[model samples]
Target chain A: MGWFKRIKDGIQTTTKDKKETPEGLWHKCPTCKQMLTTEEHAENLWVCDKCEKHHRIGSVEYFHILFDNGRFKELETSLKSGDPLKFKDTKTYVVRLKQAKDKSKLTDAIRVGHGKMNDQDIIICCMDFNFIGGSMGSVVGEKISRAIDASLKKKIPLMIISKSGGARMMEAAFSLMQMAKTSAKLSLLAKAKIPYISLLTDPTTGGVTASFAMLGDVNLAEPGALIGFAGPRIVKETIGVDLPEGFQTSEFVLEHGFLDKIVKRKDLKNTISNLIKLFAN
Target chain B: MATLIEIEKPLQKLLDQLDKAEHIQNESDVDVSKTIKDLKKKLREKRKEIFENLTAWERVMVSRHPDRPYTLAYINAITGGDFIELHGDRTVKDDKAMVGGLGSIDGQSVMFIGQQKGINTKMRQYRNFGMANPEGYRKALRLMKLAEKFNIPVISLIDTPGAFPGVEAEERGQGEAIARNLMEMAQLSVPIICIIIGEGASGGALGIGIGDKVLMLENSWYSVISPENCSAILWRTWEYKEQAAESLKLTGEDMLKNKLIDGIIKEPIGGAHNDPEETFRTVKEEILKQLKKLKAIEPDKLIEKRIKKFCAMGVTK
Candidate 1:
């Protein structure tokens, strides 16, 4: 009843005509309850203008935002696990893979690109939380590992955007191995003296946090992103204490020195470009 | 209860008989002498056999035995009283869960860092049951960086249930801290040797675990998940932990066979706790030998080989 009342209040305040509102024309801000036309959402880069909420963007969108003139060559992940564990839960692993593949129209959680940031060459490996919860199995792991290899070979800065719920449990042990694999290759990146700036979006947790996402030379998180290892419910059950308010948020993590900076989504490209230039010089 | 292992029940029974016989008889009591002697011989044989045939779960039990010597004890034994402990991650208060400092093996200066468990109730609470927070790992990284600065070799003793899973740990970046260590250690420009002196559960052990040579003590295990946790997740109950240990292939011998680890350091016949002196000697010898070989390697070559070594691990079929 309370939720219904709130919804009614929101509709009453909106000036837009209900009948004329086109399905694809308007998108409501999940945080502040402001309805914006599709044009307005794109103009704001999907950021909620009223609440400053950073909406989730896919890897393709990220490539456009960071790469020069929205032009870049996409590097194929070409990695499919072959459903390695034959992992099945309520649905067979094959069925889940097929459904996710059909929905996301992507091979795996990650998308790799060799592109330019402010006309400077760089490598980008961006993850999508929509794909299998952005779980890092062998495919995602190998793709990122290969991206690191490409960066090493090219001797360029690397930036990885993370959005995930951690390792895919369906993939089981095969998923766990990726943590080590990514971390080992990341060190090779470090040894090559290449700068890596990790950009963490909402809900970066579990094995990814334990590996490359946290291994960046300069760790940056978007505002209000949920970045941590164990999620809240598990932590609450284990520690038997009320967690600190705003804990695991980007701002909170920054205060504790876990993150180097909290970069708003709007400033990410310019900031990364500046960093690459600074380091290069 | 002395916590006799289930598989040792037969041996325990014989020992109990000897205890009873010794108390009820004088030296001239001839009726039970032959029986007691035979029982003693049988107990000895049974103990030897059990030690030889211990399953992975039983070894897990031994690794966590109450009387087992902890990280500090081994450090003291290895350093021969020449050790100094450094403190703090410099950003937060010193996490006693991770203890490290400058120490030595056979008078050669080496840096030592390890997860420390409590010897008693008060200490255990203070140690957080050897589960580290983010500061613990950052503190370890700081010390590791210090070791690298001096170009000194590092010896990391791993013993943790896992990284602390508290909300605070997550909020402060426990996973990131561990991940950063794995990446940084690979390029430290100094020899890094890791030994699983106790439980090596997932990311916690691996925080400081990536090394040129990773070793494990006999009766210790290194796995992606602890047996109990693995059992709970896979079998949906902790009751199948013993079976989980078997299936996980977590023992040091298993690790050696899989090429995840370089070698398995032998504990005393029973365990490290049964004869600490012998344990200390064997551990020291193993460290010295590994250090000798590691020290001979060029820094760049060492860093290269170290990365390749870990990259080769868990290339699952």
Candidate 2:
């Protein structure tokens, strides 16, 4: 009767009466198109339970997964990128940095943490693709350099979880020099006989791959991760030909004898711990 | 004659006029020697002015000028027919894009390595447009290690658009090859000098670019990405390449200002293509000077200094 009678024609509700579902409440698997709650997704370490596809995760997730009791001490948490080149392309580099910081809530593309992994002291520098595509700028370089020093000083193993789109273009030559800077530091790590594990995740390409990402004493990658010097699109455009399926994937790289092993996301901590133990002996 | 860029067009016109005047004075009985001399003086001034104030994009154009001198040209001129060419990475077939061998600069034996672009279209295709594949970088590493074995200082001339971007290049592990070079070159016990002779784009250039003294030739451009590529990425179009070049600050002066490079070697007015011999001479002198400075340090000290030098790069707050 109330519905039939238009007593309150155009029945109004106050703004406070409106209710809507918040974002990030549900997750959709890109590979399987399966729907699951966010909690379930997080419980699975962000990997798709239905398809076993490893969705790209940031440093926060990686640290929680690898660190002991999800506890760690962050290094250079305030180190930020300087506008060395004062670059501007549709937007000023400073503005872009601010925007990236605001959107990602990160200081830079990389975060270095000191913690015990499987009861073994380790220094891990993880890159976040959410921050400017995880492009290695001056700040990333400096942080990694410092991390290497930390590893050398503490006599602990070092690990880098690389998920990047290569060198930051806005920094220009400064970005290019980071490659040399980080590699030089890694050479010191090698000289120190410290175990340096490089973990390549999804979409690691460009200068990062050509520098520290590949200089690992033991190079490991996630399943189906994209790892290469050049992006597939650039390669395709340069060759003017169609790329075969699964090109530049972790499997392809492993087949090419570039990678040491392909470890699943769930087994990353144990596998890395085992590797550190092997290096220890 | 070498091809001229947009900024060099006026200089080219002036040069043509001077040529006509000289030809007329030589062929005929006219006494136009004064005119020829005046034209020559004017041409020199214009060239200096044009090159001295070149915009970043103009330098990029000059760096990529088809007639610009390539690595082999400099090696040949510097070594003066004393270069012994080496080939192959031992594990893979030889890559012509990369050329490395033993050479002497005024009887000082050195390992000369560089990326060599082709002189013509056919040769360009053969050289892969100066883009090295993984094997090319591997070959460079093999040569560097060989140089270290012989206690020879390594002089690497970097000039490349970037590493090869083909599927086979990726399959062959281009990134690892370059990465290995950076790590190995960092501690090679021998003095390493890297000179950016031209287009030093991203990791391709840095593949062999780590050194105690990293220098750049005037008119050469070095950056994380090529101007066109950067423009394409940031501006979503290549039309803003000039703007991108300015923003990138990729010229030799910019690199020196940023302390990314040790110094800038002056090129002949217009560019290296204008007077290749003079450019070669200046490069040889600079190399010799830097080599002398670097050679005085012991290997251990040299390695430490090199690492420190690179570690000091990058501005962070």
Candidate 3:
């Protein structure tokens, strides 16, 4: 009877007077279902403390992780995609671009910047998966090409962090041409003897993977990243069979002799600097 | 899998009517020659009209027509059966999806490479429907490097649904193979010409597509993704493929206008399937013309221009 009775008249705080935990305060580990404070999760470089899963992050987080003091000079911020095909689907491509821009606060899928990683000068081009699934369009291609040119002119090492779905379907052949365009520019970079490092993150597939993402002199990848020519779904659909465990992961790719190394997020800057120094020697 | 394109269906009916009229005349004492002649003229006008204003989707259909000449057909016709089929990447099995060889085109030794779709159901299965695996692309690159060694002009005919989307393809590094080809092709010291004779989808086409000059057949489509795939992605269904095709602007003319291609090789009326011989002849002439022009340049300059041409692609602010 005492247990059933209200315990000393439950606290009289009204709903209006009570406070709620703000949204985004906590982060959930997708792999292990562990919850932790967002700050703690971010401090671990977005890797799950329990399961070590690397959560997909954007250019902002990458810049923070790699750039010295998170300070760098962003390049070609003014460039945006044109509706060359005047493409339309359920919605016009122009509208989709606008919506993606507003949501991601990015002009396009990629951001190029030059900064010192461990005090070593390097040009980094990072893809934001939030922006149209990091699809390579004209803007992405032009930006990467310019980044390569900068690396050549300045004689600095170039690094690209690929996190993409594929080429932008809306841009059509213009998107397809980006593979050739960026690869050709990398050829120029290769001729100049500038060290080129490609970092493949989660979900690098399709045209992006088949071009500059795989053209690096040294191809590095994050652990457990999905790195392949075709998406797992497409591959499964095409092959009509269940894939093996760890298929197309960075580990699998490394084992298959496609990747040079797998570096942890915390060691990325140091690993890159050391590789650049080695190339310099 | 409809043999006749929607726009060409009326023309097919007209031709059928003409055939009936001719049969009547050939039979006992029935004079239907005048009707046959009038029907022939009408068929000509109908064909012209159908081809002239073909929707982009119809062009896609034409590009995939089963009767269209595959890569080997063009190579054999151009070389007068003088093609010596090259086999194997030397590192892996010879991929049937990609066919390459040394051939003589008008007394000039040339290296020919292309994605070879099958001519029949069985062959299509054998060829994997023209979808090249990593080994296929590697074989292509090997042939191109061989052409570079011998100072022969390299001609690549592109026709593929895409690079093969299989687990083994990824395991073998499809992307790296294509990427290496692009980089190596950009600097290869031989005249490389790429012609999209059929489907040119994504990295598969570009794997062997980099060249001093890139041309596309009139009905063929070259795009980042096929219209059906694009529609599936954007509209969440394949039913909107026609709209997707129109939106993609992936036809040869669109490519020319976009400066993604050097020129569009006009197809025979209806499509390349309607007159494979004429298609082969036109492609041969275009390839020879482009090769002559490209060969005039020094190797170093050719490489430089090739890089420059691709570098100049992609419209950005």
Best by TM-score: 2
Ranking by DockQ: 3, 2, 1
True contacts kept of 1: 0.46
Q: Give one digit per residue, the lDDT tens place, for model 1 in A1-281.
A: 46544433445645565566457998899889998898899878889999999998898788878898888888865567565445443456678878899999998899899988888999999998888889887778778888988899889889989999887665544466578778889877886799999988998988898998888888999999988887776688797888778978888878877788998878989998998899988
User: What's the distance in Å from true for residue A227, model 2?
Assistant: 1.1
Instruction: Name the runs in model 2 displaced over 4 angstroms.
Output: A1-23, B25-32
**Candidate 1 chain B, run of 10 with poorest lDDT:** B308-317
Off by over 4 Å in 3: A1-19, B1-3, B17-39
Q: If the candidates were sorted by their TM-score against the true structure, best first, what order would they fall in?
A: 2, 3, 1
DockQ of candidates 1 onward, in order? 0.36, 0.76, 0.80
* lDDT winner between candidates 2 and 3: 2
B201-295: candidate 3 lDDT, tens digit per residue: 88899999998889898889998888898888899999999998988888888888999999888887767887789998998898888878888
Better of 2 and 3 by TM-score: 2
lDDT of 3 at B103: 96
Error of 1 at A140 (Å): 3.6
lDDT for every model?
A: 0.83, 0.92, 0.91
